[model samples]
Target: MTGLRERKRARTHAAISEAAIALFLERGFDEVSVAQVAEAAEVSKRTLFAYFPAKEDLVVHRFADHETEAARVVLARPPDAGPLAALRDHFLDGLRRRDPITGLNDVPEILALTRMVVEAPALRTRMIRFQEASERALAEALQDTAGVPALTARLAATQVVGVHWLLSMDNSRALLGGQSADERCPAAVADAGHAFALLSEGLAAHL
Candidate 1:
């Protein structure tokens, strides 16, 4: 059945991603080839490429959900919810769930992946580029849902995404600095909540 096939595909994709991340953490991202990841996952290199077009994607696949999430939040916001308020609510919910995007899911493997990305120049460049693309997608969604001016929507999207990027980097730093997940996650959640509140209230007050 179509549903069963989709579920199987999802499982395969998750297995490949998990295997790729483990290998990347063991060997540097640059040092690990697609062939090696395929071997580790027990899939053909062609199959791996069919699932993830690029090597960087294998490590950063989780981030591919952001654009969809941002769009969904804006689209599903209550009638009374402003764009900023909707985003704030969404992020707060994510923080409470300790979502990986919010940096509250600071597992050791995630820390290692963060370190791998930080140390790799190419991965860093690609990440910035990916962020820009995600921002554009979010901006378009916000503009559609909120009927905001193009410039304003883009600016708002940039600010929101930038804040998220900062929180993610901060969480990684805290973890790498030897903080326990239990100790660091709550602080990151608090910081993210304060950050979103400041954004909602207007940055002029904080700046």
Candidate 2:
């Protein structure tokens, strides 16, 4: 169980993030300043910076929750399950839930955040960095779990990360183009199945 101090910290962290995102969505990411976010959150600039080291971080920190998610999925797979199988199943599950991380969510807030990230150069760049960190985490997990060499693990991570990113991008484009998540569900599932099948075939020989 979390202690009172930890719970309070979590609440404060969430409050800051919520305030920052609301401001960014309303006034635009670039237009909103750090001081303004701190004021809105009712925290000092020092406290806000303590929670988020950078302005781009205030927007991108949500992505941080999933930075090591792929790695965790791989590590926690059933004894007989292959890494790719676990990952594919996890992503499919996310789609079923309309997970915002899967880019299949049509929630207005999620759509606004996605558009904001796409339009803001800094956010885009920071998101790319998050992707890079995710790839690294997955690579390490692959190396540890599959006992593959570093180079091979890295190569596999690159492929897996790229495929997932492309699939998510396709989903986002469909929704942003006016297609609902329910309408896009079939294509998204089919695409995931096909992509994972291709990956399984390629990775089988290597692993």
Candidate 3:
């Protein structure tokens, strides 16, 4: 019964998200209201709020799903592997797969979603908060798993998160500029290698 209820709840949540994204893409994010999203999803305003605390959340929730991903990658790395290596490998894997979060995907819906986030000041601000949370999670992982000092973990997290964000943005720009993912893959791989090598040099003593 509990599993069934959870599954039902997941469906409701997905429905709300899909409906909200569809409407936001159709109309402008600013033009659509929370009430309209509720109506479109067949949920009450209160229920929609229960799932998403703010209007920006209705769009950025997918990003929020990945907020702790870097931390997870660090924690799950092989005992012999370093945190930086795990993250670099994970990102390289994402690029190969054209993961939407890596910003290399050219799917029509993903491109439209990226455009919406870029054009909407509110969404961009929310995304900044998301990045902060991701950094914090990675910092905590470093301190916990590697016994890194608090300050060092935080500084490392800052640099690492900033690097990933910049790389992802570059990939997004290439795709948005009409480059196919396949065309961008080699350059993206080279960029990742260069970025991670730089990070390795800077973080070697600490991480």
Candidate 4:
């Protein structure tokens, strides 16, 4: 169970993020300053910075939650489960749950956040960095698995993560075009199946 102090801190953190995102969505990402976000959240500039180290972070903080998710998925898979199988299953599950990274979420506020990230230059660059970090972490996970060469793991990570990136963009486009999650889900699932089938061609022999 979380202590009072920790719960209070979580509430404050959520407040700051919510305030920052609302401001950015209303006024645009570049126009909203850090001080303004702090004021709106009823926190100090120091506290805001403590929660989000950079301006781009306010919008992209959610990405931090999944920074090493691929690694964790791969590491925790059953002994007999191939790495590719684990990833494919994980992504498919995300699609079912309408996970944001899977681009299956149709929530208005979530769509707004996606638009904010897509339209902002800093957020785009930071997103690329986060994707790279995820890939690097997955590569390390691959290396830790037996019979997988370091180079092979790196190559595999790149190929796998590339598919995920493309899927996210496709889902975002469909959502922004006004498709709801229920409408987009079948296609999303189909697309994911196709993607993994294609990946398995070159990657099957390796994993």
Candidate No. with top TM-score = 3
What candidate 1 gets wrong by more than 4 Å, as runs, is 1-8, 185-190, 201-207
Point out the higher-scoring one by lDDT: 1 or 4: 4
* Candidate lDDT (C-alpha), each: 0.80, 0.92, 0.93, 0.90
Cα-based TM-score, every candidate: 0.83, 0.94, 0.96, 0.93
Encode model 4's per-residue lDDT on 85-166: one tens digit a residue.
Answer: 9999999999999999888898888899898888888999999889899899999999997468989999999888889989
In angstroms, how far off is 115's CA in candidate 3?
A: 1.4
lDDT per residue for candidate 1 within 1-207, as digits (tens), equals: 999999999999999999988888888888999999999999999999999998888976767767567767877888887767777777778767767776666666666777888788878887897789878887888778877778878887888888888987887777778886678867887888888887777633211
**Model with the higher lDDT, candidate 2 or 3:** 3
Candidate 2 lands at a TM-score of 0.94
**Per-residue lDDT for 1-207 in model 3, tens only?**
999999999999999999999999999999999999999999999999999999999989878768999999999999999999999999999998898888899999999899898789999899899989999999999998988999999999999999899999899889888998889989999999999999999999987
Instruction: For model 4, give the 10-residue run with minimal summed lDDT.
Output: 58-67
Better of 1 and 4 by TM-score: 4
* Candidate 3 local lDDT, residue 83: 96
Q: Provide the lDDT at 143 for model 2.
A: 92
In candidate 1, the residue pairs with backbone N, CA or C atoms under 3 Å apart (3 or more residues apart, or in different chains) clash, namely none
